[model samples]
Target chain A: MVKDDMANLMKKIPIESVTLGIGDVARATGVAQSKLRYWESKGYIKNHAVTDKSNRKFTYKTVLQVQLIKSFLADGYTLTSAVARAQKRAIYLDALRSFFEDRFAQMDVADHTATIDLGPFDPTPSKHLMAKRTDQQWRFYLATPES
Target chain B: MVKDDMANLMKKIPIESVTLGIGDVARATGVAQSKLRYWESKGYIKNHAVTDKSNRKFTYKTVLQVQLIKSFLADGYTLTSAVARAQKRAIYLDALRSFFEDRFAQMDVADHTATIDLGPFDPTPSKHLMAKRTDQQWRFYLATPES
Candidate 1:
């Protein structure tokens, strides 16, 4: 039971400490290695150096940053604006992460329908905050265990 | 039915064009308007000018950006590094948004179990990718409509 709980918790939160080389990040994101270095030099992205200062290593987070900048650049934004826009989008992601970590208790599916159990309601702990979807429609309700 | 589809889609995607005044943003994010203006001047963030250049209105996206920067600053990151870190996080959010938009088919709950129906598998379109949770354990499987 303890192992299962740990696994469930680990699955919800991203591992931020995983580091990759600049080459690996460039390959994953499709951004050139030179461009990645330039962004780091410009203070738009960062690299984690282990022991040696010349060796560039980036966390999984930095790879995502590169992808975002590339996406904004593809959408015709200036480099400066792209970085700014990416920063803005990051905040929304933070909220989503928090929601998943805090409220996402469980998920179940039956007959093509999916139910996301958002744990218990704050005002009414006896009822769960359930988000249900059937076909393309989504509905939310507070319901007891029996219901 | 068409109106319902539109509403559903709109609910899934965030409205990016909603603009707020600097004061409103400051009040919402608890970051001073002066700091926001300074960040703008430094090209760390942006504002939309409706008719005049001096009248600054920011999109809902920018408001989120301010909050992210403030959070990172609280975490003891330098302003430049904080913005960079925020940009990295934004990429993860973009991927999450895409997943919710493209694959999230439905959700259902019964007997305290929640299921998330992730539409259909690309390799096997007839089977849906269902993620279910009962108690603290999560399980994933592919199932047909009848099953």
Candidate 2:
């Protein structure tokens, strides 16, 4: 009974839905595994967990974060901007979930506005905010109150 | 007498300012000859006339344009974004000159008003009009009216 209780508690621990190994991330991002390692060395990003007694494990969140970094670098952001402001720089995309969630909410508002008779001043922000990674590039809409 | 008149006209035809050359451009911009060549290859800029056939000469305008491209790329404008919609994109730093010029003109007006002690609402623009780049990524500024 005591052994079963311990196993049950371990199962209840929260786990991120998506897990990717370094090789998987390399394939998804079109970046070499060695380059990913280099980015990690540069403090751009890190894997989800380091339990890799043999190789590292990356989560989906980290994968997205790397994608962002790649786009920013290619766009010509210095490493500092590519890293985002120090406070906003999260190692995992999960850490960035709230921000992206807010972005999605903004997108919803834009989508809703698209169908409405919201007048000329009510512009759709979706077209404005572009997200990319070679160097940190973001074009986001600043929501203006309906005129 | 006709030949002498023609010679005088030729002499008066504006000595061409040495057509400024690649070596002069390298000296003026502190950009390596190779980097400038690479930038030209990358389509950031072009030189219209290359006289002195074997050595290759560039106009002073070409030199300035190269420096401008370097500044924009250094400041994080992606090559694609910078070149978007145009054969050659203008430098981002050029925007600074216009922004500041407007600010200075506004200060002159504000100064005159402060001396006369006019009410705040009397000499102000309604609903702030901002002239900005519609296509390029924007940086917002609170533009006051020029005095």
Candidate 3:
């Protein structure tokens, strides 16, 4: 019955189970207490209620939102910029995912583990050119298909 | 054959493949061009040695390294801290991987996933709480776990 009844509400965070203090939040999110206070002061989050002698109980949604925000901040977003473009959350996330994929690919210990686009060559520049053109002292940036 | 022949050398950076003008590095990393030039002047990175007549080229490696530094900066780090803690090539790549992992995780629609963990509950009030308790809001900081 618990499973059947709860299944209906599973799509949303349950309000009753949403009672966690700072310690619980810290354990769940791996964030520090001092930093959470700073986030509250900066208005990155708002609590739904403060009861049972003024202890802050965070909702599940707040936890996920905080996680997303933390990820963006980690990916080189300014707090102000992150706030302003909060709705376009996907962009920063994409950058983060691509980074992970590249790392995982590198972990593959196989001959074809490298994932690079050497470009669509005309088939004339043989492996010899690949060697000679690779000037050890020079630096070059290859363009991504989109960039 | 080319890939096989250079398997040993693959671990070494293809420094020649990095490409960035100071301006590009600035824009991509959100650092000022003057700062980029200053960092280079300070020997964080060096330009290629050239014949008397030379065209400037920057490798993608430098750009990616700069991106890694920028990620650390966004995570509330200073240039000094980043250089000290994240200078190892593996560290840079790990930062990139973690960033991307988060982004990828967000992409999954997560179709109403729910999990529950339940255990024993002691309803008895603790004797340790015999003293008076304060009512002001207890503030704390928390960040989601690293991806």
In candidate 3, residue A7 scores what lDDT? 16
DockQ for the candidate 1 complex?
0.02
Worst 10 residues of 1 chain A by lDDT: A1-10
In angstroms, the error of model 3 at A97 is: 12
Ranked by TM-score, top first: 1, 3, 2
Best by lDDT: 1
Error of 1 at A136 (Å): 9.1
CA lDDT of each prediction against the hidden true structure: 0.59, 0.38, 0.37
Candidate 3 chain A lowest-lDDT run of ten? A127-136
Which docking band does candidate 3 fall into?
A: incorrect
Residue range A1-147, candidate 3, lDDT tens digits: 000111112112222233445554554566687877777778776654445467565543455445555655778998766554443432332222232232222221112121222222122222110100111211112232323
List, residue by residue over B6-53, the lDDT tens digit for candidate 1: 113324224343344576567557789899999988988776755665
lDDT of 2 by residue, B1-147 (tens): 001111122122211222444554665566789976776677665654434354455543455455555555667887555444122322211222222222212111111111111112111333232322123222222234346
Tens-digit lDDT track for model 1 on A126-145?
87656566665545556686
lDDT of 3 by residue, B1-147 (tens): 001111112112222322334544454455677766666676665564234375333333455455555666778988877654434542323332322222122221112221111111112112110101113211111122222
Q: How accurate is candidate 1 locally (lDDT)?
A: 0.59
Give the better candidate number (1 or 2) by TM-score.
Answer: 1
- Report per-candidate TM-score of chain A alone: 0.70, 0.46, 0.46
